[model samples]
Target: MNGPFPAIAEASATGETADLFADIRATVGVRVVNLVWRHLATLDGALPWAWAAVKPLYLGGLPDQAAQRFRETMIVPKLASLAGDAPTSVDAVLASYDHSNTINLFALGALVAWLRDEADGGPPPPHGPRLRAPDVALPVLASEADVAPETWALVQRLNRLGDTAQPLILASMYRHLARAPAFLERVEAALAPVQADGFLDRAIAANRAAAHETAKRLAQAISAQRPPLADKIETSVSAFIDHAIAKMVTICRSIRVARGQPL
Candidate 1:
């Protein structure tokens, strides 16, 4: 699960960090803690505070509700269908991220909005049952050793989509799918137009803005009291919510939409 950006390897986490990782997986109904959370843990004092801040949103089903609303409203663009007979494992990988990222986007988005005071109202009351993650196992995120040289390069290239600015954190989705080079090859073919025509960033920005606004509405669900959070923590959280997670959510879900699959 290593990336260009620094993060605590989930397996190597110990003591409180390990405990937080476990809590995240259980509460989010996902098998693994996401890269963002793991990255946050790399910073001093960031993980514990941030997790404490956001855990209530997860418990109250605020993120679950927000994610459900988001699914209905997402403007997924059309892409050419991927041609190939990939295994069921491919679907499982995408579904795992599709479910996990959507929830994290809102859950973390709400945290960002609340911290910035972009949303009105205080914490929300409990909103019944939390949404369940799909029953799927995401492939272990691939490293260069695990994939062909060309495929590893393609994975890195795909990670740079919409990188008019400096490259953001490497997306774990591309890495996860690297185990299926042919699948990623088709993905590159399908998305090349979107990237070349400058639609990729537009689509991602629109989705991010929409999620940001929706998350602000859900901001009342944040349970943390207002105090000055660390600048580094705020900056990192904002960047991920603004960039990597949003972009991947759009791309992964768009792929599903084009394939006539349920997202």
Candidate 2:
């Protein structure tokens, strides 16, 4: 995690934190740790407790199942077709984030539901095998100094799409994409109109609401007890779910979809 976000850098994590980070990578089957999880590591007692509660969900593939269902029902605004002309690396970057973020969105969404309300007595989540993470390697996240000034500014601009939150935190995807700024410029060109007409916001809102309920249902299978830091952890998870994860899930999918990629 970099920039203004309060997170222990993955390279800096040691001891229990480091081991838990490894478990998260192995269990999620993604090579990189996502920003939300890293951000959680900065909170005292948050990572161990939160990860313990959700580990079974990942093992059983509940979040993966939940994420697919979310995608099926989720509204993805079709952008006008000129995007996706970037390099294979750009496509790979989009593919990887599209997979990992959507999964975390649902997994953490389930955690949020379990924290806020009682799980329904409905049947357990259906058994579905989760896909292994995409093997494509993404470039390291670009710092402002690494990219041209205008490109870095565009990264900030794209990160602000569909978000009205104050003191915005950068989405990791945008930072990674900055490594390919031309692709990001294309992304901005594609999404700028979508955001203006409010199609993007509606889609983000619909998906967020749907995911909340789906995750609530998935939370039914979780038997993990509340940790002492549940309140604080819930607050952090809710923020990401409501803000970054909620918005990016749709944006990433839209980018992939417009690029003629199958999500």
Top candidate (lDDT): 2
lDDT of each: 0.82, 0.85
Cα lDDT for residue 1, candidate 1:
45
Model 1 ranges off by over 4 Å: 1-4, 121-128, 225-229
Measured over all alpha carbons after superposition, the RMSD of each candidate to the real structure, in angstroms, is 2.3, 1.6
Best candidate, TM-score-wise?
Answer: 2
> Tens-digit lDDT track for model 2 on 1-263?
44445888778999999999999999998878888889889888889888988898898988898887777778998887745357677887888889998898878888998999856567777868986789888888777889899999999999999898776778888988888888788889899998999999999999888888778887887778788888888888888889998999999999888888865
Give per-model TM-scores. 0.92, 0.95
lDDT of 1 by residue, 1-263 (tens): 44445888888999999999999998888888898899888887888888998898888888788778778877676789863588677888888888889989998887888778778554553376677788887777788898889998999888888654464688888888888888888888899998888788888888898899878867776666554546677678888888889988999898887767765
